[model samples]
Each structure stands twice: as structure tokens, then as C-alpha cells.
Target: MTGIKDVARAVDMSTATVSRALRGLPGVSDETRVRVMETARRLGYVPSPGAAALASGKTRTVAVVVPFVTRWFFAAVVEGAEEVLRDRGYDLLLYNLGGDEAARHRVFETSLLTKRVDAVLVLSLKPSPDELIRLDHLGRPVTVVGADVPGWATVRIDDEQAARHATDHLLDLGHRRIAYVGGAVEGVLDFTAPAARLAGYRAAIEAVGIAPDAALEADGSFTVAGGVRAGHRLLSAPERPTAIFAGSDEMAFGVLRAARELGLRVPEDLSVIGIDDHEMSVIFDLTTIAQPVREQGRIAAQQVLAALTAQYWVPEQVVLPTRLVVRRTTAPPSDG
Candidate 1:
């Protein structure tokens, strides 16, 4: 059978307007409504239960947009959210922003504008301020995971402060000259982890009254391979740093591998610290900033569900605290 979307297409009206027209609801012009109903009846268009529920006020579903599903952080968030959403009888419609900037833009500007979902839960998307405002006006609640969106309720970690704390851990161990290994995936602008971490690293150096070394900045790709390439470049410098602060545990693992290849001793020759306590962080003894990724996911889903269920939930930015996890990867500078 034909659908409201088909009828909407036939009459060149929105599915929402078509739905209102079919259900005899107010807000649509009588002429347009007549055209939509006529098109639907003549074309044998049948609205699905989900659309009907929407017209009647219910769906038990939320739309989740994420930058990447393969990434450990994003995957962890989804796993956590899935568990919560599934338990509460809420359906999740996951939209993957497949590692492409253009694809992400299309997903945000077009795909998410659908009327199928009840609420929205966005993962680490930093849309332009204008786009975010437009989303706010879409008449449904929104929740952000892994970062803050000014007007919506956000469940995330204190990324900047966590990075700063990680830097302090390295500094406390007597390492003064340090290089940064930042995991900045190419293409997505929604997440500002790299910028925030860089700020924290700079802030920490300034707090200790050490001049920031612009030469020590190296971009890693949030993978072991990316870290290895970055590590080689940073290590090959004329003035190699005695310590490295990697933006992620995965990148830090790469640095460790590179150090081993170059016959450098861990903590004795160079110290390394990273953010995100990946499962392997402990196995590799990587000192890191540990944030509860899964917990953030669960909380974000709860916020979305609350919005759908008409429960009282204040839209506020909730930053979960992070702690510095001390491991064997850090030590006093040997020359000191």
C-alpha cells in the first residue's frame, strides 16, 4: 500500500502536514489538507502504525546520530545506550555518520529531519551554532553524549579538565619537556576533543610556568598505526621530548610500540600518558585519564527516554568527573 510519505510526495507537502491532514488535525490550510487527503485516498496510501502513533502521540523510539560506529569510544557509547534503551522498551534508530564529512553533513541536514523519531540523542556532534539552534526549534527534546550542546541536556565527561589533570600527572613525575600526541580524526567538526585537550596541555604548562613548545605538537589518528607514525616523527626531532602526552590510550599504545622499535626504555628513556582508559590501557601500563564511556551512554539514553515519556528532566549540561589513572608508564626524568 502507498504511505503518507508517498501521499506527501504526490501532493508536495510534508509528512507531518500530510499526517495532520489525514487525521483531521488543525494547523494545515484547508486547501492543502484537501489536496493531501484526496491524494492519499486516490492513491490507496496507508499510514503505518508508527506514523499513526505519531498522529496520536507515541512511538517509544528515539533517533541516535553518531559520527562512527567502529570507533571504540562511539561503540562503547552505543553499547551502553542500547542496553538502557532496550531495557526500557524504547526503540533506537541509529544513524551512522560514516567517517566522511560530506556524509555527516547530509545525515544532519537531511536524514535527521525526519518525523519518525520521538527524541534525539547525538553523539559528539558539534554542529555550527546555527544548525544547533535549528535543531532546538524542531519541537522535540535532544540529548548530547560526550560533549555539551548549550541548550540541550548533555551527558559527558569533563574533557578539558581531564586532559589537564593527565598533563599534571606527567609534570608531577619530574618530566618538564613533553610532546603532545593528539588523536584527531579527519573530517568531523562536531567533537572538539583535540582542541580542548590541547588547551589543557597548554594550560598545564603555563601553570607550571614552562614555555609551550609549538614544535612538540604531533597529530595522531586515534589508532595504533597513527600513533606509531606520529611517534616516529616526534622521536626523530633534533630535540626529542622526554615525555609524551597522547590524547587517547590507543595512540599511547602506538607510542609504546614506536619506543620499543627505537630501543628506548619506557619511563626510563621516555614517559607516556594518555586519555580514555581503553581496555588495553592497564595491560600496557599506560597512565591515563579514565572517563566512564559506557555510563555516559546509558545516561544520555535515559535523558532521551525521559523526554519521550513526558517525565521531568531538566535540560542541563552534566559533566561526569574524570580521574587520573596512575600506571607504570610515568616516572621521573632520568637526566634530572
Candidate 2:
């Protein structure tokens, strides 16, 4: 069987140097590290995980905690993170909560991940006070995506600004009777995006001298079916809105479906805008605020790698930019 010693010999480096390079430890020159990695690969050397962990006091594994794996956003982030981890010689362990509150509580309240992972990457969850204390006690590096937490690295877009942009687009098109479809302010999972986006929508309308109306806002629950229900409710009201701003592309798709069923012409009769620019958004020709979802994941993974490899590293809060993508779905409201 191939071993580190064999790799060291083939690369003409000492066993210690080979080990450090393979483990992605500091103090090795980049050129030497590359040569050592190439030699190890050519020699088909695979280090024993158990032995390595014992020697280095690190499992060289990162655990990614997510609400669920089926969603496009979560899956994209994981894919980007996994690519970075693989390139850096780390293994990824996924802890999917499957959107169950009980499952989420158990994962955060226990030491299930303490010794198994070198670091953790949490996605889209705002940890509670108790959960924060438990995570702090873990003594492991934790980086979060889509939520800002003190004393930890965070990577996310400005959701409020994105929503404001979406709302502003409709307002710019002279639509005063605008409606909002979004997740509840207080959801079971306690996600950060919904509230921020809702705030943005309110801020934009208020800036235009339009008082925020409770009747115009509906909880879409960040899902297609929820958006459809919200859409029907707003459209069926005595005073229907001329435009709708959905918090997510999936919900926007639902709103579009609802409009079709109600025999409303998009852009001409009921303009719509959404966030996330999901892959399916193009099929619907939906205008949206596009965020770099996969890039956020990749950056978060890199932050974890930095914390693991550097002798001294400070946590940072990285906020990426979002942009408005124009499409066929948004236009000035018709004079009915």
C-alpha cells in the first residue's frame, strides 16, 4: 500500500515536510507544496485519516449545516463550498436538518459535531441565544452564510437593499398600489433574509410618500404555493395591487401562475418583480435582484480554510453586492 514515506522519498523531501504539505500546514513554500502534492498523487499515496487526526489533532473535515438540501440556494452554496474544500484537501460532512425545528435544536444543542469537524459552515440560520452559547462552547471555527452573527465570520448579500431595489423598480414604473409576498417576519427556522427584505420594501415605498399598508403585504412563506395563495388573496381584494414584489424567485413564479389563472396579463396588467434570479427565473422572463449565491458559499468555505490554516486569523463579515436584472416581467402599469 502507498504511504507518506514513499511519497516523501519520491518527492525528495523529508517525511515531516511531506506531512505538513499534505495537511495544508503553514511554513511550507508554495512550490514545494505543489511538488509534494503532485508526487503524492502520482505515487497513489492515500494518508490514513485516523493516523493523521491523531498526529495533528484535527479531523480535516468541515461540517456544513443547512435547513434542507433540496432547495436550489442551499444546494448551490454546498456545491461551491465542497469544491473549495476538496481543492484544499478537506472532506465535507453535511448535517441536513431537513427543515425540522426539533432536528435543528438537537444538532445545535449537543456536541454531535465537536470532535468530528475542524470547523462548521452554517447556512441561512440565525442562531438563538442558547444555540449561540452552545456553538461558542464548541471551540471550533464557525462561519455563517446569509446571517450576521457577532464574533463569527459571515458571508451574505444585503437583503434589505436587494428588496428595496426590487420595490423601487416597480415604484419607478408608477405603480402605487404595490403588494409584497414574502416569508413571515417570525418564521420557525428564524431566517434573516425575510425580515430584512420586508424592511427594504417598506422603506422604499415610504420614501416615495406611500404609507406602508398592512393589507397589501401577504405572507408567501417563501414558497411557490404560499406565493400563489398570497397572490390570489391580494388579487381578489376589493382594491387589487397593480404590481407585486416577491421575496424570492420561486414565490414570484407562483405569483405569475396565479396571475395566469386569474387571466391577468403580466407587465401590462399586473407587473411583478422578485429576488435571487433563480435559474428558472429566465424561463419565466422574471425581472429580479440577482445575488451571487454560490460565490457566497465559496467565500465562506475559504474563510473556514483561512481560520484552520493560519496561525492568527481574524473573523470578517463579507457582504456581497446584488444587482437588478431586467426582463419581460416588469413594466409601467397600464392605465385601466
Candidate 3:
């Protein structure tokens, strides 16, 4: 039954000052803020979310829309965003669209409208013009993670550059016959990641005066199973590639699995590299381009929180950096 009044009395401050301090609003000195927080914690005075929402016109909740919660990148981003939101005395409302068009439509049309959140953080799901309009109608500040959307705050890595760097690494290792494993070239709307990555791979190959061959490209769909299937098709060719550049570490792992099934030694027979230094990448010894996936999520969450608190309202794009991680899976082509 402890309330803000009890904390205010313990801290010898007015209810307004206690509220401001708890809500992290300005006009409260750091000393006062700390004292109020300590007193509130000591007294077990928890602010009622409903009461706070009614008083401040803010639900103190952020809605996160993602295509797939089960994926490593999305899961990591969600964890990072949740950490920041929880520390800021806010809650997270998750909406997993499951990468299905119908599910995505239902979420934007119905689920989002019914949610009482102050801001929305979309992860890796590019909203079309119509979907964007619908989101704007929600009247909540929106922040996107993964790709830049005009007129909205975004935090993302340069997917094309990351893919190019991975490809260049293989090229530098004297890999003339380098194959690419990524998502399908077509059959999706509002999703440009696959195309961007494919472009990067081709750019790297062409920069080296090598004609990009469609035969060397296979659609992995950004999944382990997809990579495994792609790997079989690529390796079954009469003249297989000396190195494989997978768009994701999961796919690279799948490639590794397929190589083993075909009695191919990594680096010796087929060097493999990938993007996203996923947690399992170490176990797989995958050479990859490491992007700050969780950090991007955290930054996106911070942007939405800033908008909700009236701290930052201007929309901006934030592009994080990626690094080439040299691991056991990548090496100079045996022919070299």
C-alpha cells in the first residue's frame, strides 16, 4: 500500500518533486533524485502504471514490433531494449508479426491501435507507405531498428557495407571462386535487406575485375536450413567455390554442416565467412562481420524514450559500425 506520498514524506520533499525525480524529469536536483529514489525503494513504494498513465498522459510502455522474435538478432535487440526500458521505469509490449503478410497487416491495423504505449520501436521490419501511414496515425513517436525510414528515428548497421567487407575479406584471401548465400532475390515486399546484401557481394566481386556469376549465388533465406539446402546445391556443382560468404552466421553454420556432410575441410576445401557474429558463431568458429545488434536495439529504445519524454523529437538516422572478425573458418584458398 506504500505510495509516492510515503516516499515524499520520508525524503522531506513535496509530492511533485518525488514524482519528477521518479519519472526522471528535469527540475529535480541529482541529490534530491537519488534521495527520493532511495526512499522510494526503501519504503517499497511502487508507482501504479495505470495511475501514472492517467496523470501524465503517457502509458510508460513501448511497443516493439518485430518480424521474428525467435531469430538471434531480433531476440538480442529485444533484450537490449527491454533492459533500457526497465531501467527507465517503463514496460515493453511485444508484437511478433511472424514474418507473415497477414499477421503483419493484423498487427498494424488492430493490435497496435488497441495498445496503450507511448512509443513504438520496430525491429527489422520495413513498413510500407501504407503501413507507415497507419503507424503515423497511432500518434506515437516511432523509432526503427535495422533500416532507415524517412521521417523517423532509426538505428541500424550498414548491411551493404557489412556484406561487402565480408566478401572483400574472402577476396583478399585469394578466393577467386567465392559463392554467396543469402535470401531469395525476389518475392518479398518492404524488405530490401537481401537485395542490399546481394548488391554488396556483387560489387566486391566486380571491383576485383571478376564477372559476378549467378551460378555462384544461392538463396539461403537467412536461415540455417536454407543455408544447408543452398550449400548442397553449390557444393554439388562440378566446379565448386573455394570460399563461401554467407549473409548470416546461422547460414554460415549451415554451410559448415553441409561441408562436413560432403567431406570438405573448412579453409582447405571451402573457406566460409558470414555477417553477424552471433553468440553461436564462436562455437562454430565462424569468421564474420560483427555488427552491434544489441547496441542498435538499445539505441532505438533510447530514441523512442527520448521522444516520449519530450527530450528529443527530431527524427534522425544512426548507423553503427561493423568489424571483420577473423576466425578459424576463414583462410587463404588452398589453391593459393
Best by TM-score: 2
**lDDT (Cα, 0-100) at 199 in candidate 3:** 92
RMSD of each: 9.4, 2.1, 2.4
**Alpha carbon lDDT of each predicted model:** 0.82, 0.92, 0.87
Question: Which of the predicted structures, 1 or 3, would earn the higher lDDT when compared with the native?
Answer: 3
Best candidate according to lDDT: 2
Q: Can you give the TM-score per candidate against the true fold?
A: 0.81, 0.92, 0.90
Q: After superposing candidate 3, which stretches have Cα over 4 Å from the reference?
A: 3-18, 111-115, 185-189
In every candidate, how many clashes are there?
1, 0, 0
Residues 1-336, candidate 1, lDDT per residue (tens digit)? 676678888888788788878765568898987788688879988666565675577565777888778888888998999899888656788888776777667756664555767788888877677668667766778888877667779988877798789889888888888999885634455466877888889899889999888789888877789899999998888788999999889899999999999888998999999998998897998888998999988998888777765657678788998988888989888974
The lDDT, on a scale of 0 to 1, for candidate 2 is 0.92
Tens digits of per-residue lDDT, candidate 2, 136-206, equal: 78888899999988777999999999999999999998999999999878866888998999999999999
In the range 141-209, model 3's lDDT, one tens digit per residue, is: 899898778778899888899899999999998889999999965653355678889999999999999
